[model samples]
Target: MAASSIANPRSDTANQVWTDLSPLLQFNNMEIINVADGVTSFLIHPEITTTVGRLKHCTFMAVLWEIWCSRNRARFQGQDMSAKHIINRSMLSIRAITIAANFQKILQPWLVALCQSNSRNEILKVLIPKVVRWLTPPPGRLKMNVDGAFNMTSGEAGGGGILRDHKGNMCCAFAKPYHGLNSSLSTEALALRDDLSICCSKGVYEVLLETDSLNLLHIATR
Candidate 1:
């Protein structure tokens, strides 16, 4: 409940914040609990005083603070911030704190490297790559992109596909919700089958099928 006070009045805000931060600040299964529970557990553990543990603990606090501040800014000043922006700001703040206190001993090698970079432009250049344009299908051929997602906790899977012409105009799109999927491979296979069936039904003989699953690709080609 580290930032519970800030989110008490807005349940939706709390959900959004959690959704954005969960992937960035994952904890071990035993350490996964309410924010207050996790914080208390960390405090009680002797290892929490170690250099690495202390750095991680401080990082968690900084990220929580950044999330609260970003929420307030969005609510009052009409300025919204992305999760990436919050993380970047938190890192910079931690770097500043480490510098002021001369806490280099506790800093990780990666953190030391980040601090040494100093230049925002250099960091950006290293972190963000140039965008590339999507390739268009050859003339007379339709392009189909299919993907699938599996939720381990829910034991459910979903798949979707989109078909576009050579000019990149969308011709058709489809999505399906599946339950009790054994694995991601099954979901992906189902998606490919459905997408290809749709194209066949539409009289599309020539197609450029694209999928991220190497297994599926190999299966189809073979």
Candidate 2:
């Protein structure tokens, strides 16, 4: 009934979608008469801290998003996507989220079993987080680390950098705003150049530069 109200013109389609997806959810034998019933069940049924509950929440959220996307495509793009395609998309979306959140240990088995019959044998890749630490420069040297970013929509760019000594004490820092910058690499180079100018002004000649951008590093080396 709730699905019918929201998607009035496509109530029949919405009900069919709900009917197909209902078996996957654990509603504790309570009849889900409407969308509100399904939502209330999800909210109260699971203690989200638990692994099983988290998986269920993620699956439901992804499925809802896929459903909304399907609706929008049908209404605006004049496209009719199959329920199977929506279901598969939802699975892939949740699978990606689970792997990214490192829920492989807890939810991977469940996902594998649920999607075992999927035609495409998509591998759920687990992300291994790397430990990153800053190393101090040599005794007589100063280190400068710089970074830059740009917004594609507004065409705005900014760069910032910090200068640190051998003992890792902050010597100076600079942040600058720019306009009409085309790429992030150019911004990074500009930030590096600005920081280098600051070093020159302070007469700190012995310097080691560090940047996370490999392309900028290549440019600097050349």
Candidate 3:
């Protein structure tokens, strides 16, 4: 115990040793390269720290703490667990959770879907709104409605919007072109700005712009 303590004492060296070992928990694509000897965090900014740390901690914790749940799932149940059935393992897990979380369980279907998706980016085109609606949802407002679209194959982007008055009557329905590949954020911004711009043109002020994208709300406010 004394020799082990001397060799692996709880110092910066020990911390870094932990860091190196924990990264094995990560998917190979998610690992950070080019970390210098003194660099403690990527981006070196406090804002990015929480983002990076949360991701690393969650993935690390998931793999380290829960591998038993995912590893050779059927063997513990006394079944034939082998190579041919291995890849389908996570899918079986996700399909079960997809029904339970009603698809709100973020990791399961998402990672499985990404691996199975046609373009991955294209799947996000269909997925982002569903996820947004589930997460930072806003009730439909009678005063404003927002819609957005992005097509990965053709790279075509478009948006439509509508605004109604207090009586729940339609005042206008609007549409416009979008140009960019900033993914969901790009289309989200255009949709909100389109409604705001229309309100500005008509000298109308103070509107409830209904949108599902919380990131866009933060971006638009800034």
Candidate 4:
């Protein structure tokens, strides 16, 4: 269908999607990850993430529910975002389904129903909490405790942690906004040292403390 577009642009704008421009058709080797039995999530290999993936793949997830509405303009009548409603009216479209399929094959009707397009402090108030909840592992699920902070341009900082069992569930969480002022040498050292202090205070005998700073690990251990 799209192949016919290059030669005949004005001739066919209805009934047939010009195959050539279809994102699915253009990106030949891209693979979609199966997240569940019926759901799919596709990540453009990192190499392409900065390009087409950023443009197309990212769009579908951003304001997924709202876009789902807009894409189905005829059915939805208009895109709507209402905080009080908890759920908005939307007409699903082929475009929306394709986008969902690109991300994960399992597009819950509820997710498609409540997803909104706005991304701001106000929206984050509504969105981030939900995302965090979704990302939170269930009870007894294995989870990692991670934290980060900035001290000097490259110096001492504070950190946080959370404990979880084998099921990706977070058993505990912790954080400290500011550790102290130090050089690059003491930044991570302070974080690790502080983490240890916290563990002792809370009586956490066994847990994982994760950090991205190599220098801190070295200093804290020594």
Candidate 5:
């Protein structure tokens, strides 16, 4: 398999990927002569036959897929992103999978214990409160908050905004549907423009604008 990977220029540069990954695999006690051998070892292990093991095995496969994709991009698109980038991406993917597995392991037992207790007071004690405080505008200024949502299946998007006074009273609210937007950035920009236009129509010059999108805020401020 390693020879085939090295010989076939169209194949996934797996030999290089394996070379970069070998140390980590050895550290995990999964050292092998080749990728196929490593997979065979995983299949034969009893722990790997369990549900969580299967997920880990799948994550390993996904790493290989990502490596192949990166190699193809470098070969075809002339985007020679380094092997270290591929390794970093794989590590992040595996870390996310591990975190999800640990979260599920803890959540199942927590849910069971919660059900067994069935006391409102016990539940309230375990729950943590999250509070969000909205800032108010100065005396003469009107605050406008804008947001956007997209529907992937329908290829449609919508944007809305609310104008509020210093005392947090809503002066006006507007929503508009959009079509054929390629990305969330476009929708956010459109939302901001729509809110600005509404404010202009309402003759409110002193304005404070807010949005949850960091990209939009950066662009607007710049």
Candidate 6:
């Protein structure tokens, strides 16, 4: 087995892509001893605490992971790998990680530009994050806040809710796992049903229901 398919891809298409992406990779196309050295050189100069450094680290790691997956597919499954595919797959991971890291404000423009042009040097405008605050319910009424999540890939669904008093103190909370749920809307409906059942059992009639889903809220109010 070779040291790394990413460092020295066998295919001409991959080689050309590596050349094109070398500018973004920074330390690429250099005479490095091994994969570790190449990665170390890529990360050594910049402090990972900085925005550009974080983006570089994520891109480098995602590229490496995609490259390894490509190598496995080519070697074990007798599949042909395309550098474009690797770039696309790696970008998905990079984008997700970037969002999770809260680097969207700083790094999103670069990612968008990278798709159009492989340039990573420009810093675009800053995006302010939206602020959300919870409001208290009327006096002597309990507020029920609920949320549900459905996984498109795994076919898993789950929901949870918390009941709070007018003072914003948690009274009760419940969570349940669901399988074979078709859509998130259905899950939200079921959560509402479960929460209402809990309230009914407790003889609580004056309840205010709160949910982040506008569709669910409209249907519920109607």
Global lDDT of each candidate:
0.67, 0.70, 0.48, 0.41, 0.64, 0.73
Q: Whole-model lDDT for model 3 versus the true structure?
A: 0.48
Q: Which residue pairs of candidate 3 clash?
A: none
Candidate 3, residues 23-122, lDDT tens digits: the string is: 3223321243533311234213233234333333333333322233323344454544332233234334433433344433244334443243433234
**With candidate 1 superimposed using the best TM-score fit, by how many Å does residue 167's alpha carbon deviate from the native?**
1.5
| Alpha-carbon TM-score of each model against the true structure | 0.48, 0.46, 0.36, 0.34, 0.43, 0.46
Q: Ten consecutive residues with minimal summed lDDT in candidate 2?
A: 1-10
> Which regions of candidate 6 deviate over 4 angstroms?
1-127
The clash numbers for all candidates, in the given order, read 1, 0, 0, 22, 0, 0
Model 5 Cα shift for residue 12 (angstroms): 46
lDDT over C-alpha atoms for residue 90 of model 1:
68
After superposing candidate 1 on the true structure, give the runs of residues whose Cα lies further than 4 Å from its correct spot: 1-132
Q: Between prediction 2 and prediction 3, which has the larger TM-score?
A: 2
Question: What's the C-alpha lDDT at position 24 in model 4?
Answer: 32
Candidate 2, after superposition: displacement of residue 158 in Å? 0.4
Highest-TM-score candidate:
1
Q: Compare the candidates by lDDT and give the number of the best one.
A: 6
Q: What is the C-alpha lDDT profile of model 1 across 176-222, one tens digit per residue?
A: 99887888888999999999899989988788989989988898889
Weakest ten-residue segment in model 4 by summed lDDT: 83-92
Rank all candidate structures by their TM-score, best first, as comma-separated numbers.
Answer: 1, 2, 6, 5, 3, 4
lDDT for predicted candidate 6 compared with the true structure:
0.73
lDDT of 6 by residue, 64-103 (tens): 7777788788887688888888887776676556555656
lDDT tens digits, residues 114-169, model 4?
34233212221222221113244455334445556665653546666666675655
